[model samples]
Target chain A: MEANSSPLHRGPLIAAGILLGAGLGGFVDGIVLHQILQWHNMLSGKLPPNNLIDAKVNMYWDGVFHAAVWVMTALGLRLLWAVGHRRDVPWSGRTFFGSLLIGWGLFNVIEGIIDHEILGLHHVYEYTIRHLPADLAFLGFGLLLLLAGWALVRAGRTDTTPAAASH
Target chain B: MLKLLATLALLLAATTAQACAVCRPRVEAAIHAPDYTDTLLLLLLPVALLVGGVLLLFFSPTLFSWKPTPPRSTVAP
Candidate 1:
């Protein structure tokens, strides 16, 4: 293909988008569920943080989770930097933001399925007897985010202008 | 750097030496716990999927190779 005709290298953009989204999404889970809501910890179901030692163990696991997400965010930043100068990559805000939502949605769905359902780890709101509804609702919201993100990314496909060139 | 290393070594030694009877079993239980590998995998599944999906999306342009529209001619009518 001719140089001008070559399609954009969307790999970097997509990578950056998803990683950033997942990282931020992970933060939301850590903060809202683990902290504010006091619903659960990383290992609450398996080893409820009832006593000091068990609590310490849960805290340790939570730290591990946070560390993993921090690394993901860093990786996303690196990918964004790598694609910053490339002319072929469209620097559309919609694509990036959309990817973020998708990433977050993906996190919620995956976490909801594996942790809440499959592993029986913890529910979104653990205080009530009927926790399944809350968990399902969380997954539903994640689905909504995925749809919105997908739409935004599709919209971004028409934006072919180089970001730097426009500035 | 040397002081930091010494301090770290001391901390490690102190922690090992100071393991109380009550703490030892809990620590041992945590370390020797069965089925934790499965738990770890479950936790990691979503992260792996997100990373995989993103990579797939990134490389999709190459796999599909959708043709770009030709640039408009600069000449005016």
Candidate 2:
């Protein structure tokens, strides 16, 4: 087959999109769940923030968590800049956005399982005694995003448009 | 001129940035905990897993393609 007929390489683009999505997902959890709602903290499961000192301690740890996610976001942007320079990767918005969704879903699923279920580090809603429902809901939402993203990405495979660098 | 002076003053006051006098004791005590390492690792686990998987994905996309619906132009010129 001719080079023109070969499949377009999309790994770099997909990877960049996923990294960005996961980083954004982390921010959402940190901001909405941890700060705005006052639901839980990084070590709330292990050390409940019941008092002023303990709450301040948890806040400090939360800052650490935020710093890590910021790094992830920065890395994703750098990768995207590199991917734009390549000629092989197709420029499909569907593929990129789908990848973002997949990344977010993966973050939610992995974090929910490890942090909320196995390790008991924290819960989705720690204010209540029953945390199972909230945890399951989080996982379920992740699964839904994963499936939807997979479908979009699969559809994007048929697009023949090349990236700007190739043009 | 005022902003510059204020910034310099703030930099000089870095030593007192830990916490207010009231919470200084608690903050100082918490800062020296041995369990911080454990907590740090536990917290970073998920991010590590995701980052590793994404890096791998960058190299693996060339291995396969959807044969049923190939791209219209396939290779970019």
Candidate 1 error regions (>4 Å): A1-3, A163-167, B1-36, B60-65, B71-77
Q: RMSD, model 1, all Cα superposed?
A: 6.9
What is the C-alpha lDDT profile of model 1 across A31-147, one tens digit per residue?
987778766677777776667677666766776677788877887787777667767777778888988898888888888898888887766776567878989998999999999
- Cα-lDDT of candidate 2: 0.82
Clashes of 1: 1
lDDT of 2 by residue, A1-167 (tens): 23245566777888999999889988998899889998758778977888777787888888888898999899999988887876567778898999889888998999999999999988888878999999999999999988888888888876645575455
Q: Give me the runs in candidate 2 sitting further than 4 Å from their true place.
A: A1-3, A165-167, B1-20, B61-77
Q: Give the per-residue lDDT digits (tens) of candidate 2, residues B4-73.
A: 9999998897786455667868865884589888889988999999899888888785543432344356
Candidate 2: residue A25 lDDT (0-100): 86
Pairs that collide in candidate 1 are A11-B58
The residue pairs in collision within model 2 are none
